[model samples]
Target: MNLLKSLLIVVIGILPFVVNAQSNNYKVRKCFGYQRDSCTTSANIFYKLNEDSRSALFVKGQSSQTIVSIYNGRDYRISLCWDHILGNRMGFKILDRETKNVLYDNSTDEFATDFEFTVTQSRDIIVELSIPGESTLSKSEGNEELIIIRKDKEMGCVGVLIEHMITPTKGF
Candidate 1:
């Protein structure tokens, strides 16, 4: 009985780590899409695994945000990608941390998949993601309700790709 109890405790403790490891792999795959190496070569400022700006899981119609520091005089390319199975409706926005000003909203730009810009000052900015809700439709020529659902649970992996925009050196 004591041995069983010990094994049970060990399994319970390791469960979360295993789940998270799987999630990270899924998220990374989703991020790069068909071009796995694109993310690596493009991102000079990659976020660490399980870090604030790395990845997240969310259901449809949910919104989440993270803060990442941006340096002055350096341009950045902020890109967002999600589980392709979930469709292309996922996107993110950039907000100024201190004043809360609306810096960039993807929705306003027709849900752009990526954004590039240079910050004048160094500070933390909020990166907010939005996932559209699942669509529901009434059955045609039938009284039964029709609902579309994924084979897997309604969870999505969002990856924020942060790439540094290198500047060209000017000859004096």
Candidate 2:
């Protein structure tokens, strides 16, 4: 019994370090922040959204702030799951390059759904998501990255740890 207890204690002590390990992604351009042993995802990921910049839109009022910059004719999807129910609020400012007009600006509100967007130009872009300091964010800001760029009194408090940017290699 004594020997068994000693082994168990050692395993428990090393578990935290074993868990809070480095993460990697093939498409992760920049890893700005990180945290471990917090949420179900195990690790939070932040990547630079620079691939497609022309067609940019900020994903406002989301559990995870999803900022995506994609070129013309590319399909992208972002999925964010929280420990608790997330407030459904997201807005988009889709720009029309040729006319240089605000084509579609809609606030996306849903209980929990996979947000999707398509870029229409090969230009630089910006997308942002915001989450309220509610239930889902009960734990510490384990690992988060808030983009320094703020527009028109916009304060960023979105703790979106994981993000994925999808780009189309061929076909213009």
Q: Which of the numbered candidates is closest to the native, going by highest TM-score?
A: 1
How well is each residue in 5-114 modelled by candidate 1, as lDDT tens digits?
99999999999988755545644554333222233334444422222336555566667788888878667777776765557676678898999998999888988887
Distance from true location, Cα of 92 in model 2, Å: 8.4
Superposed Cα RMSD, model 2 = 11.6
Stretches of model 2 off by over 4 angstroms after superposition = 1-10, 13-68, 81-107, 111-113, 134-172
lDDT per model vs. reference = 0.65, 0.38
Instruction: Put down candidate 2 lDDT per residue, 1-172, tens digits, no spaces.
Output: 9999999999999987764332223254222222112212322233333222221112223332233445566544433332222233433344544454654444534423334555566653333334443322233264684444232122222222233344446776
Clashing pairs in 1: none
